[model samples]
Target chain A: MDERQLKRLLTEIAHEEIPDDMNVWHEIRQQVETANSRTTRRGFRLVRTGLLAALFVLATAVAYAVYQGLIGSDPGLDAVNQANLVTTIEETQELGGDYDWAVTLHYAYADANRITVGYTVTGAAPARDQLRPFTNTLLRDSTGRQYTWLPVGGGGGGGGGGSSDPDALVPFEDNIGASFDASIIDDAPESLDLTLTIQLAYATEDARQEFGPDVMLPAGDVTFEFTVPFIAGHRYDGPQTASASAIDMTLQDVVVAPSLTRLDLCFAAPPSDNGKPWAAFADVTVDGNVVVEDFQLLSPIVPVADSDCQQYVMPLSLVEYVESGEWTLTIAALRAPDTESPDTVIQRMRDEAGINITPLEDGGYMFSEPLPEDMTAASAALADILSEEQQTLEGPWVFQWRFE
Target chain B: MASLVERYQVHAARVAYLITQDRSQAEDVVQAAFLRAYRSIDGFDPRRPFQPWFMRIVVNQALQTVQRDRRELSLDGDRQAGDPSFMLHDPGPTLESIAEQTELKQQVRQALKALAPEERAAVVMRYYLDFTEREIAAALERPAGTVKWRLHEARKQLRTLLGETEAEEG
Candidate 1:
């Protein structure tokens, strides 16, 4: 008989006989009844004893909490981060004081090799440096402006905190477009020592006092450590096996559809890393125009100090979706001190952002098509949730590109 | 005032039957399940019906055991629960031959494992113990329509697993 018939027969549930082995339940029942009988015989005495015992326990617990709270037991994530205190505070409960913030890290989201740290500041100006793995440092001001500490000829080999050349810290884009999908997260251990410093404080009156990132604390540079949860796909030990060969940007397969709007972008990371593992992030574009860019990704999901870090492979984002296209993802090459050469970055970006999104009449994206007519009931029930979301967007779009 | 174990005794075998797919595993699962049931009986609602609630706990524990064992099988809703369908259809050599005797039954057991977790559960509750679909849905915290769909898919998959034709699966 087929599995269906077989399962039909097996779904029949039946009860069990009392085991001849051990009757733990039987003994437990007897013990409970004995306890109950004892209570009935000396009811008042038993109640008084129980109440006294409970009070003693509650008093002990409250005393312990009071001691801890006085010594600043567990500071909030914000306070610990701002204080930058490496050691636990015994006198003050605020972990991160007004200047430096430190925290007990629990997880990381980067691949094992590159530590990714995220931090915000109270004031806009401060001096910052990563302690180990590399001593990379930078400076920022009250307006959230970032400066790259360029060591004349320093960005060599081990990178970041490695070089100690004549320094000329130049103004760099303080905020890079970093979009990550933590929709599917898992536990992967890693961390970054986040240090945010706001300098140039004496220049403005408000800068002297009102400068926390997003109006939180006050004005000034603050350094702290915040932990991030890991994303499963990015974790790797040493290197990646080139599961898919790297694509040459010059010969990228371009699909041209004219009427498409709304594009869904994703990155396919190389399974592992070799330092040569091509997990690079970049800005995406169509026809020489920038639709999306700055994909900074940290692998393995989270990063903690004194532990390994995750690398940012290809950071993918929806480049600007129109209804259709004969679109060319103009691979822009970057000439930077902290990124891969532009051409290679573009090629890596294209491979990960597989251009196989379904262009539809509603301009919204669907990961699947109606199951081929061959499989069993292909019922509309399967289409339930997807069709529900599709009904929201108004108007229709067309696609000139024959998606073959 | 009655002990918890005594109250759920009648449904024990039925609960074990659906979960382990084997009388031995089912028996063990039920006994352990009851011990756990007793330890946490304070949480029991005095107002609700006990059978479905007990079955949910028993079935959940059984399914977890199966998962731990990595048993792959199917969930079929059509097979008549009480009938010994295997013995009637596949009569082979020696009744002494494990293959001829219990093989078909075991295959039936394993086939049941292939169904999606919920669908298999549905089939077990509905056909095996003859609980209605509504009761199965309530036990699972799922809607009746979703339950029907899961059952339909499970049955379809099982038909393929069991080598049944269109009429049997449909």
Candidate 2:
């Protein structure tokens, strides 16, 4: 009835007896029994029916092959493969903003899941120096959805170290070539009507001087609205179901292409019109070896129309495979948050303890907090707060399947 | 690994169940948390205590589970099945005392739910697990000031939810 009694009761309840049926050791044992033995292969089959896939590619390439020939071999357009290109939308358009920066839309490669756009930027010396667009640098489609662009040859280098006056003239003429993801235009028909817009982003003077910032300030945006016509890539529909933790998820289709390899899955989740579900396939092993280290598996879920089932696209990796190989994917493992900040917490603790904190690269702050300086006092302090906080898991919800 | 699961399964499940208030989801969260913890165990320093570290994962997993299932979650911690207070029985002739205690526990759970997930974790870690403010700050991977702020804000919200004062409860 009082605060003290209430606290006691709550603690009692928190420590309340768990049900005997609630023991998960058996399930855990089964899951961790053997990495390979635990998984039963589903729909074991070879990819693309082998010879037919090659034929389909060759057949599809017939019409576009001529267009590819017409565009010819421009070294600037080498970021995207000539074969992967579905359409050649070689139209040059100029921005009507403060500065003259022309962006030429070359071609577009689109699958059921992803679309990558190829473009080249040509501008005056000041324009080239002032503007640098990174991924999500431009918003596309009629909805103004954001698309991050990763440049070809990793060049978004509008890097200048000095912080000068806004009106300072730095004259240079250059052709900065890059490619941006136009994938934000989610549902792509045979043709895509895209409105690509890039706004001028200003970098701080302090950041420029100290960290050698890659971004510069000034200028209005260039908006280009054009229709990019392309043929839809291949999609293989195979209904396969896997269940874990009482949730049934079905692999409805798989889209294999040079641009992206995607798995289309459907599962029952509460209807959410906004934001994708946090379902991810973890510890993905392709033929017993762990690959795709740089690229994280993305599960972008959209609500299935008029149903409790929501559909999601699980992008396996950026690595494209010509043949479908046996792949093992795991779900139900919660990913850890960025632990770099925890190091900062430790550093702050060290600062409190009168120990110096040093900075490390990749957002790591080094410190041995909670350790006393002298041995006589160190024993007592060491008995408390051991300065390490890394933990791991037994395993994850795994699903093994093959393409035939 | 088996021993680790056997040792903390009950506690982890309890923490997850309390946070999610859904038995099935709590079990899934605990399972996922254990899996995550096991996978990342190589990074774990052997010197640190495992309970708080593992509990942090449990709490985070539970919060994420709740978030993903947000549409199904009710305003009062997903109590769609039945009120837990009804399950409580008076052990002695003090029927009124048992009822009051149950009512208070229910109020506490409701009040705890009103706070943000991080704040809820802070309150539970402080009161239920009997962790010091500094220990909680470490476990939650937050600054001591942040943990202190969350606790203060949680207590205020709880006080307001429990009808303004200790005098009223008494």
Best by lDDT: 2
Off-target runs (Cα >4 Å) in candidate 1 are A1-404, B1-4, B45-48, B71-107, B164-170
What is the C-alpha interface RMSD of model 1? 24.5
Error of 2 at A237 (Å): 4.6
Worst 10 residues of 1 chain A by lDDT: A150-159
Q: Write the per-residue lDDT of candidate 2 for residues A1-404, one digit (tens) a residue.
A: 34466467556565553452256755654443332132111101000111122223433332111111111112222313535455667777665344455566665554444555555544433322443322223536555554543211112112221113445433211223233343344454666667755444333445467656544454555566677554443445667677764557676665544444556566554322322233343455678766432122332222345653433332222234324566665554322222224555455446545553333332223222222234223221211122222121213445566655
Evaluated on chain A only, model 2 obtains a TM-score of: 0.44
Quote the lDDT for B125 in model 2.
77
In order, the Cα lDDT scores of the candidates are 0.32, 0.47
What tens-digit string does per-residue lDDT give for candidate 1 at A19-138? 322123344345433432332111111111112222234333321110110110111112222334222311211223332322222222222211222221111112122111111224
Question: In model 2 chain A, which range of ten residues has the least summed lDDT?
Answer: A63-72
